[model samples]
Target: MIDLHLIGIGTGNPDHLTGEARRAITQADLILVPHKPGKSDLADLRTRIIAEVCDDALIALFDMPVRDDTLPYLTRVDAWHDEIARIWAATMAAHPEAQKIALLVWGDPSLYDSTLRIAARLDPAPRLHVVAGITSIQALTAAHAIPLNTLNAPVTISTGRRLRDHGWPDGCETLVVMLDADCTFQSLDGDGFDIWWGAYLGMPEQILEAGRLSDASVRIIARRAEARAAHGWIMDTYLLRRRA
Candidate 1:
């Protein structure tokens, strides 16, 4: 069986890598790196991190398949994952001598990433090993210097689409949203909620804005657009809480 190591490299910083993640990378026979065509910065960052932390492994870089945005959202993502799986299989097939393969996952694989799902599609599925890294949620909380929850209250993690599609969730006063292409907070009408929003968390170009949603929503949207244009790619997450 192939040995698969899903190592979380943390957010965007090379130093965010844990000792365990470093060991996993160095121990692997081969490490597969995905190269997103238009998002070359992200690809470069991942490659740099691997280079800094893993000195002994053979690194194989492969082009990432573009997800077809024309198809309906879910269907499009499904097709994209299929394409990625095919590429991954081919890559591994070419390197049969690689008994242990490592994938440097951004943040934890257990989060919103689909690397785990794609791994399942392998013909002879590898024995999976996971080393958890700092998630965006952790980075957000740490950057904001605030606890994720208040007085034993619940915190719900969601996506921007969910927030727009289904207003607010029931029974949860605190919400953390990720994978938001649009500023969905504007859709929420920005009432009494306080927001702690951050862009490029844990990176050198990190930007943060926090205040009443009503006060900060517009600025966050404008700043996010400017930064995305400047960097060509942006990954951001925010926390919203209805003041208790």
Candidate 2:
């Protein structure tokens, strides 16, 4: 049976890697890296992280297949996952004796990432092990040096799509938004809500802005665009809350 290690490398910072993550990389027989077209920089970032942690492990790199977004939402994702599984199978088949394989996961695997689910589709599924890393939320809060929620209050985490469709979550004073290509804060009716936003958390090019949503919405949107242009990519998350 193939032993697979799904190691979370945290956000984009090399320092976020834990000692356990370091050990996993060193112990792996073959480490797989994904090559994404039009995004060579992202792959480079992954390579840099691996280089810092794994000095001697054999590295295997392969092209990542783009999911056809045209198909029905769930169906498209499912089909894309199947293709990823096939790609992995092909990559591993070349080195059948490589007992320990590792994939560096961005952020925590159990959060919104699908790496774990994709691995499940592999025929004769490999024995999986997860090494948890700091999540984007943790990085965001750490960058800002603010607690995620007010003393003992609850926090609800949701995606941008859900925030736009459902509005603020019920029964929760704090809302943390992620996976937002569109700034969903503008869709809200401008209540007394306040926002603490960060883009590319933990990276040197990180951007942060926080204030009453009414005052900061436009600035955040403009800054996000500017950062994306400068870095060629952006991953942002925001926390919104109102005093009860």
Candidate 3:
């Protein structure tokens, strides 16, 4: 059985790696990295992490398959996960002697990441171990120098899809949004709201914007578009708070 380690590397920054994450990488018999065609930089970042932390470790690379968009949402995701699991299995099979494998995850694996769910589908599933690292929300709040919660008020954490489908969550003074590809904040009324946004957090190319929602919404949308175009990919998260 494989001893799988899902180590959170925290937004592609070396400083974000913990001692536990370093140990997991060094101790692993194999490290698998996923590559996307146009997003080679992401794969490069993981490679760089390995080079810096564990240069002597054996590395394997696999191409990540794109999800089929034609199917219904949940169905599409389930099928995609199955495909990823298959790819993972095939990769692991190639190194039959390697009993310990590690995959570096961006941010904490438990938050807005599907790695854990995909691992569950592995046949003769590996023994799972998770090493937590700083989440994008933590990076966002830290970059903005703001408190995530306001004086005992509850904070609602959600994805951009939910923010678009359900509008602002009820009973929460602060909302932290993640995995927002569409800049969903533009869909909401911007009055009396403050937004703290960050893109490519913890990386050298990191960008941050914050101000009244009314003032920052359009700028964030334009900036995000330009950045995505330039880099061919982008990962961003933000915090929105309603004025008292």
> What's the TM-score of each model vs. the native?
0.97, 0.96, 0.98
Better of 1 and 3 by TM-score: 3
Tens-digit per-residue lDDT, 8-56, candidate 3? 9998789999999999999999999999989999999999999999889
Listed per model in order, the count of residue pairs whose N, CA or C atoms clash below 3 Å is 0, 0, 0
Sorted on TM-score, best first, the list reads 3, 1, 2
By TM-score, the best candidate is: 3
For model 3, give the 10-residue run with minimal summed lDDT: 166-175
- The lDDT values for all models are 0.90, 0.89, 0.94
Model 1: per-residue lDDT, tens digit, 173-192?
99999999988888775777
Q: lDDT: which is higher, 1 or 2?
A: 1
Model 1 error, position 222 (Å): 1.1
**Collision count of model 1:** 0
Question: How many clashes (backbone atoms < 3 Å, residues ≥3 apart in a chain or on different chains) does model 2 have?
Answer: 0
Candidate 3 overall lDDT versus native: 0.94
lDDT measured at residue 230 in model 3 versus the true structure, 0 to 100: 98
